[model samples]
Target: MSVENVMTLEKKKGFTLIELMIVLAIIAILAVVLIPKSQIFKNNSKNAGVTTNVNTVRGYLETKVTNNGGADSYLNAATLKTAIASNFSLDSSTFVPTGSSSSEQLVNPFDKTKASVAVADKSSGATNNTVDTVETSASDGADGEVVIYVCKDGYVVFGVDKGGDLTQTFKVK
Candidate 1:
């Protein structure tokens, strides 16, 4: 071959700018598609973590109460709070809102200003937590009826809210 023709063939052997640009564009598109799905997967993981923590708290309470000889019925908010407080051995400092006057333990992660409890009572049932509307302890008036051992918005509830039908859907005690 001629010297000039050989030089031209060598020049064409490497990738052109257009080819490089196309490859970069494909990679960018794939990254865009995958990023959001990865975020969603991360959220699902957080939800599962919350569920596990809340259940751990519940199981502890159930075991304590069952072994204690059916000590007392949760009559009103105060009595229930005291009973739960003693049974679970939860410290009042864990209460959310940043002070002794807060009353409730944890705020919902979705809405950090609002209260959410791991164990609640349904006063006729409403929302997905039909078991019991979150209530303040009538006794202490500085603590929520539920101990809220895990992150807020944790604990999955199941079934209808009835006189005594509130129960955790999963194995959260």
Candidate 2:
């Protein structure tokens, strides 16, 4: 090849600094836009997981009550713990009951840690927001823990705190 042709070919072999900088800027912009969206999606999935767990426990309770011939009975902490231990196939590595008594814990989807199931005090009135109190307890709240509040007439309330801005609760008659 001619000397001039060879020189031009060598100069055009690689991209210019401006071209490389433009590509980097595009990538940065994409990251800025997509990173927050990915985090939102992650949080949403975790929230869904918490919801599923709450429903699973609720179903277990309902089934137990149904099998007992629709009888309204009081389910204390120990009774609930025994029922859960009997019904679910727990993995020792993940399942850890907290209290020396009969406290049971479930894995929290938000932090992947165990949360204890606590019973609310009887004096606490069962209002529309009763579940909120259970979820916001200073200890044993959130982290995938469940709270059970049994009504005098045999109704049961279940609550779960999902750590941030999300608390779920349901009532079963």
Candidate 3:
């Protein structure tokens, strides 16, 4: 090739700084848009998983209670633990939420707050916790948003916060 042509080809071989910046800017914009959406999707998937876990645990409680001779009786945390240990063996005992409090919580699969207890959203007082013998989110009443918890009537029930209301559809009571 001619010297001038070879020079031109070499100069064009790599991206210019401006071109690189433009490409980066476009990628950055895409990341900005997609990152938030991706987070939303992740949170949604986590919420669904946590909801399912709560419901599954509730069902286990129901069957266990019914199968026992107690018609309306329920197991407290202590009894529930005992029953789980004695009767039902979880294949992955690691999946169980261990702590009744943040300090004692185990690895919750969907609790992105990094707490062993999962909440539908952020706040304090709702970290897989119990208050006044009632299971409450860590920040249950602080923000006027009643953070829901899988608490006991001495019996576990399933529910979620629907526009600031604790709503449940389970009819095993």
Q: TM-score for model 3?
A: 0.51
Q: For model 3, how does the per-residue alpha-carbon lDDT over 7-100 read when each residue is reduced to its tens digit? A: 9887877878999999999999999999889977875665555455446555665676578755236554444544543332321232243424
**Candidates sorted on lDDT, descending:** 2, 3, 1
Which regions of candidate 2 fall more than 4 Å away from where they truly are?
Answer: 1-3, 89-106, 121-140, 161-168
Highest-TM-score candidate: 2
Give the per-residue lDDT of model 2 (tens digit) for 1-173.
89999998878978889999999999999999999999888877776766666677777677777877552463644565566655443333334443343224454566544543444443235553332233333253455555556544343444454444434556654
In order, what lDDT does every prediction score? 0.40, 0.55, 0.43
State the lDDT at 20 in candidate 3.
96
Compose the digit string of candidate 1's lDDT tens values, residues 1-173.
89999998888877889999999999999999999899777655544444443454466545654675432321333444454444434443332333343333333233334333333433323343322333322222111122332112232232211121222443222
In model 1, state the lDDT of residue 134: 39
lDDT of 2 at 122: 39
lDDT, residue 19, model 2: 98
Residue 57 of model 2, lDDT score:
76
Once model 1 is optimally superposed onto the true structure by TM-score, how far is the C-alpha of residue 159 displaced, in angstroms? 13
Report the candidate with higher lDDT, 2 versus 3.
2
- The residue ranges of model 3 lying beyond 4 angstroms of the native Cα positions read 73-156, 160-168
TM per candidate comes to 0.47, 0.67, 0.51
Candidate 1 similarity to native, TM-score:
0.47
